[model samples]
Target: MRKPLLMLVLAAALNGLTACASAPSADLGSAPGVKEGSTPSKGSTLIIKDFADRSITFPSAPQKIVALANGEMDIVYALGGTLVGRPTATVPAALQAAQSVEQVGSTHGLDLEKIALLSPDVVLGNHPLNTKDIPGVEGVGSKMVLTSANSIDDIKKQIGLFGQLLQKEDKAKELTQAIDQKLQELKTTPSTAKTRVLMVYGAPGTYMAALNNSLSGDILVSAGGENIAADYPKLDNYPQYAQVNTEKIMKSNPQLIVIMTHGSPEKVKDGFMKEMQQNAAWSSLDAVKNNHIEILPADLFGTNPGTKVVEALDLMSKRLQAAK
Candidate 1:
């Protein structure tokens, strides 16, 4: 079943750093030493340290795998790894051909029974959402590897680590190198104007603003756009994002507004515009007056676009240039 776009957006909004509790450490089980550059031979015992510093051991290279997150699924596909199960969402175009893969819940929840039935050798997931199911996944004899990515550097590291896990280090290196090169090229790309942008995720009534520290905010800054939401105090309720304040937005007068939505981009943008048009304050906003509004692609912006980071960056750069 394809995952709903709104649920995916809400999942991303709730998965920010502040929404999660501190991860508990686990004991490293008996396993062979596997360093950063060490390649694991098939059937060799391999040990991996996850994002939360917990160690997990695999008795052998994982052939049948389950990925509970979009980013993890993307990495698996990018490295030519097969998936026995994937979250019930629209996966990247490259992996759409694997229609036989079973739906294994979503970022908001997991189907432990379905996952166990798959008899996967390894299960990849992230913190908080997958926290409660970690032991259960291990109980089913599947090695659970938790991963995280909040910045460009973290994304690069994850690509390298996933490559290591799949024994596709060469492919991982090539992908990361290409991403680095594209990012570097963007840095030198000349822009005659800089637009203060308000990056948001939500529907009409409910909205959240991305801060400078968030992945989308970081990408916007890298693409030569300024995030106006950065100046406001962080929301205690959502540290990575802020409540949309009309007064603050009016005062800031962002020149461009970028909406990240999971549903039909046209419908979402139209709904938001309709709501804003009802308010005199919103009508006076610079972005509204100049009509500098854009809807970001859900595939690239809704979740952490793993190997597609460069593509996301390129899109943002082009939009920023056009807005100028």
Candidate 2:
């Protein structure tokens, strides 16, 4: 799945954060290493930590923070931490209600001065910004936490790491458990049929579906839907724009079609459906005839999985399972 186009897409926000199928529960049996009072001193302000490290030792817990990446912002919210600042236009809609937080320039081309002026005690950044922004972030006297997540396990670990940093271990535990339970719930339920699905990506003049392992493909599998493109497994095509022959789409005869376009919900819906309707071959597909098309929000259906990803699975399951 393509990353959602934040209209004002700030410069190089980190990329390639992937999600995977759930792992065995036994693998997650233990919590991260940290005692209740092990928090960094409130007085000590400087600290640095890497994503791979299992433990973080901060001089003081960060009370005022600026999140420079989406993952960091999500983690902060998951841990119930107060964010004093975040990159503009990068925050998810779920968090748009937070009006008090300051928008320090875009993470990619960050306004160093605005961030510095915040006097943030800690700055959270991912791989893309870690090296470039570290010196400036540190020069401003704030600690910087560098995080990178490539798989679902990494995402879980981040939840725990942020929990420890924000003293919300309990919240972290609860959210993790919820995710684990949802995966388990999906695992045990048998799908009546592996509904063939096509995850159509939309751009100005390009439209295509993803094979397995991409964000959209992962969600389809998690929801018990099979990607019709799985058979044509082609590599070296990222944000691949291979023109999908309409005849091929008809032949695949996907049981359902999901249109994922990035933009405001209203615009994305009107445009994708109108386009789908215009394509003669697409209009002839079983999915289109049956009206089994779902128009998903750009942000939720775009890149990177999180709580909303889990919800997407449930939604797909319920929709796909309904008798046609």
Candidate 3:
């Protein structure tokens, strides 16, 4: 009788605390035929929505995990959680080299079979992919969780939350404090002048920038530089080109035009820089006159305005000081 009682208790704990091991799916509503938005409560489970507005809840502290989103990977690393697999997407190089980590699939597509083999306890994804449930992430064997890190504040909160889910709450607090302190330092540094800077994004094939609350634009603001296109007021995708007449850029006439290109900085000159250099209309601009055009990695300007924003601030602050 005592043995049977012990077995029942063990089963209950495993049922509630054990992490799921399967692929993501389209209908991640519930364990069986449940609805979306409503999550079942296991011991210490918590549900939260991310920037992409997807629903996710963790059963117990997950150890073996796979991240389907780069931002998700960013948060995981920041919280000091180990990853079992990741999408073979444009995640930062330093993140990919983690010992024992594997690439299950790319962000554009999912490899259910490959992901299944990894036996992930929890799968992480966000935004565009949040709503689309994959087979491996939501099957009976695996549990799917959505991570929300849309804004800088959201990123900070997710750091704490990930720490809780990974049983590293102390590490989460320390990292969050470090990032906050760095951001404050950047914000407090007095600006000599508002250097007119054009933060060009997108691939050469497509060129664009963020306005208002965009991550890139926010970084520019935090770095003590003024975005030449601040008046645009919208955020779009990579390769989303905004056709500014040469006159518009000339009118903005940034003191220093920073061409931010993805991939190699060398590639920056090949795309928009070369075109701008040869154009007669842009020749009169101050940036062109002084050859103040420079290139930087997309990550320094890309990653959501979280701790990475500090890196952008450091880079931009140095450039602004040099321009003086």
Candidate maximizing lDDT: 1
Best by TM-score: 1
Error of 3 at 298 (Å): 3.5
lDDT, candidate 2, at 7: 19
Error of 1 at 88 (Å): 0.4
* Runs of candidate 1 exceeding 4 Å displacement: 1-39, 264-267
lDDT of 1 at 311: 89
- The TM-score measured for candidate 3 stands at 0.75
* Whole-model alpha-carbon lDDT for candidate 3: 0.62
Question: How do the candidates rank by lDDT, highest first?
Answer: 1, 2, 3
Model 2: C-alpha RMSD to truth? 9.1
Summarize candidate 1's per-residue lDDT along 1-324 as a digit string, tens digits: 334644543444345333444434444542212454445776687666676566566776689989887778888888888899998887678567555689998757877667766879888887545766666666555667776666777788788777877778789999899888988898787756687899988765567888887788888888889898987677896677888777778888888899998776777788767766666788787777878898898878857888888989999988887666
lDDT of 1: 0.76
The lDDT, on a scale of 0 to 1, for candidate 2 is: 0.62
Which stretch of 10 consecutive residues in model 2 shows the poorest summed lDDT?
A: 15-24
Better of 1 and 3 by TM-score: 1
User: How much does each candidate deviate from the true structure in C-alpha RMSD?
Assistant: 7.7, 9.1, 9.3
